[model samples]
Target: MTVAPADDVTGEYLALRTGAGVVADRFEAVWIRGADTTPFLQATLTQDMSGLAAGEITRAFLLTSKGKVRALLWVLVGANEVILLCDKGRQADVLRALVLLNVNMDVTIDAVLGPVIEVIGPTAATVVGSLGYDVQAPHRWAFSEAGHCVAAIGHIRVDLPRFVLIGPSSDVVRNSGGVFVGDLAADAVRIEAGEPQAGRDVDDATLVHEVGALDGAVSFTKGCYLGQEMVERIDARGRVNRRIVGVVVGTNVIPPHGCEVVQGSAVRGRVTSTAESLYLRAPIVLAMVRREVVDGSAVTLTWDGGSAPGTVHELPLDTFASIS
Candidate 1:
């Protein structure tokens, strides 16, 4: 199997870190509309969905009753409708779950089909600003062939400048003055940036806190929604059984997924994603490890019929992490 989703992972990674790269987006869009759009979403999503003026976006979660993540959502409060971004393959599942709980609420949930483009990397803001809008805004939308075009902060960091341009057209991507990076390369960049991909680093079994999404994705002040109780419980507890973390394998080869992360003979956790980090110039892996294994701890990652000693690290990895 390939270590990355792109043929030229190293080049794509370099482009984003140093310059700019227009990444082809694979995420699907969900359009939620009606008079009750604001209140309905306010109750269900983790973000305070009210008072979001037009051209603003908020990261929110649709969670299970047990507080496991159903979907990591990015909500754009538009004029005609409220747009949601969800996992590409599992969008129907997201919509179905939303519809099931949407009783007595005047909201319409539907899937949007089209190509989405993300112009990201350090120079992402420059590329996006040239396209005729402020890259600083959290939520903004335009028009396109497949659907409405939207721009927002691409990832969860302050230092790295990243912006996502979601629309039906590839024209904006071409005109963005950046080399096009595919999903594989984008995945590597995302992993390096500590951005968790749903169904990979996180799943339906994933609690919001496990991936460290409490401050950004889940809202404490918002009214009751599905899975609020569990979220609050986890918040009160202040830690999780296993939290996502970064690992630096001794081997130069990228660690394969499903590799066991062990401390002594007991399996503490497992690696979820790994990549040949261009910035670190070493192989890095993202693992879901028990909370007992503190940062800077030593662990063994067994993969590909061999085992390598790896040092534990915090999220956002090392090379691309903000020092300031």
Candidate 2:
């Protein structure tokens, strides 16, 4: 992971929150092509992919039959094919999962080699619009004359809309308008939003609801999918032992990832991601905390030699309400 300087990161973070910032090559795009594309994905992924019109996108989870997350992806419905967007380096896992689930279906999965551009901020639409792509609302998408796919994506925070442009990175950056930033800015925002990354914040061992990803990524009303039974059972029961939550540290120090979150002597959770937030002027992190530790609960994060005091916050902290 590459990081910008602290000052540069702060500027970039502000650009993403107040205006717009473009990040290239931060995500991966995999193309699932063939006539059976929708049905194949609909049968495997947790979300309903059927009846998705062209220029629409939905976030979904590819899970095992036992309901453990295999991949967290955004399914972009195209006329002839479906584009799956996921964290960089997790494409191979997603491809393999789709391959195993193919059965006798007529579908071909291939990695799309191109620059993936992420446009973040409130004016993200305006920036992408200048590039001749009209991504009307969050979850809607459009394509460009030069073969770029532009999808307006929903963010954890309501005010900051995101747009993903998959095509030529250089061309997208040169032609589009926004402050260009690196991974650090994105990490800060993602941590603050309590968004879980596939391999980092979550893994094959984790369940969808355990990370608070069920609402957008899992569909109860949809037809049977790979993990439907486990999902439905859990939904009926109505809770997971642990869930993703925000932890605002009392000081400015960013705790290293994988630290134990303790409520007194009891181990409550583990820190998944952390960043020094410019907006909050403190260290913020995403952690998979035990259910008993609700928002506003005070907790101590401990590692080998250091510990920090923090307060648990629900996902998508309320600090963004002014802009939201």
Candidate 3:
């Protein structure tokens, strides 16, 4: 099916919820191959990479020495090499960081300038299945006859399974009976799922624990890695000053990024992402708010001259699976 235009955000949004939407160029891949690839990654990433068998994938974080997030990655371990997939426009950063950390290790990092297609929504599995690949369990991947790597990445909505097909051909999605969606819809689903985007929902200054998706990306039992000390320190404290939270505005107006979220006179947080949620029929945002702003708290979002009344809620927004 033809992809929806920018104005038709709801068209693409609904397509993904009801069927499938193919999102391309949402991610970039880096191929790392060498005798020391596994050990190199195990020492650099927040996730434990030791004993990661072939055909498995895991979400991991590459952090600065201070425990700030550098890039969120999905490491796909193949027979001879491991592929690191990160948000679009981040391959260079990850590559450079790895190179600096190589030191005496022997590894070759090359950017894979291939087509990255994300098949998302409820029927995403069916679309991939029709293409002759078994719907691999979450965090598992299989190579297609055409050499395209099909990885069953986790979901945005619990019912909406997401798959990433990374390889040379964009034709994999053709005639697959899936709707093509624009970036807006895909981003909305991500916000609704409480998944953070690299430069948008998170950045170099953001800590790994401040985001809600930590349980999957972090390995508390793993050996030391870059930024491990801060992670352990914060884990011991069991709290952070601020965290990424969701704000729902009961109106059509969408707040711009950086709009201040206020409770009375205090500026509690700033909105990092905004979307007109079709599920709630209102505008929603992902914001890094002070920890005291608990769920179900009433708040107001204010910008230069415009303000909208909203309420704070935990990430994923509770109404994700109840689309009507």
Which candidate has the highest lDDT of all?
Answer: 3
- Tell me which residue pairs clash in candidate 2: none
Q: How far in Å is the alpha carbon of 203 misplaced in model 2? A: 0.7
Q: lDDT of model 3 at residue 115?
A: 89
lDDT of 1 by residue, 1-324 (tens): 012234666677767777787766557778888988888888888888777876676788888878788887777777757878876676888888889879898889888777656776667767777766555554455443444465665566445656656653666445656767766566677777787778888898988888784676677886898889998888898778989998877778677788999998888999998777766767888888988889999999886678888989887775455422
Deviating ranges (above 4 Å) for candidate 3? 132-134, 156-159, 318-324
The regions of model 1 sitting more than 4 angstroms off are 1-7, 129-147, 319-324
Best by TM-score: 3
TM-score of 3: 0.94
Cα lDDT tens digits for candidate 3, 1-324: 355665787888987777888888989988989888888888999988887899998889999989999998988997668998899888899988888888787788899888898888778888888777768888799887877888998753354578998874656567787778887788788778877888888899898888766766789997989999999999899998989999999667999999999998999889999987777777899999999899999999999989999988887874446532
Q: Positional deviation of 292 in candidate 2, in angstroms?
A: 1.8
All candidates' lDDT scores? 0.75, 0.81, 0.84
TM-score per prediction, in order, is 0.89, 0.93, 0.94
Q: Can you rank all candidates by TM-score, best first? A: 3, 2, 1
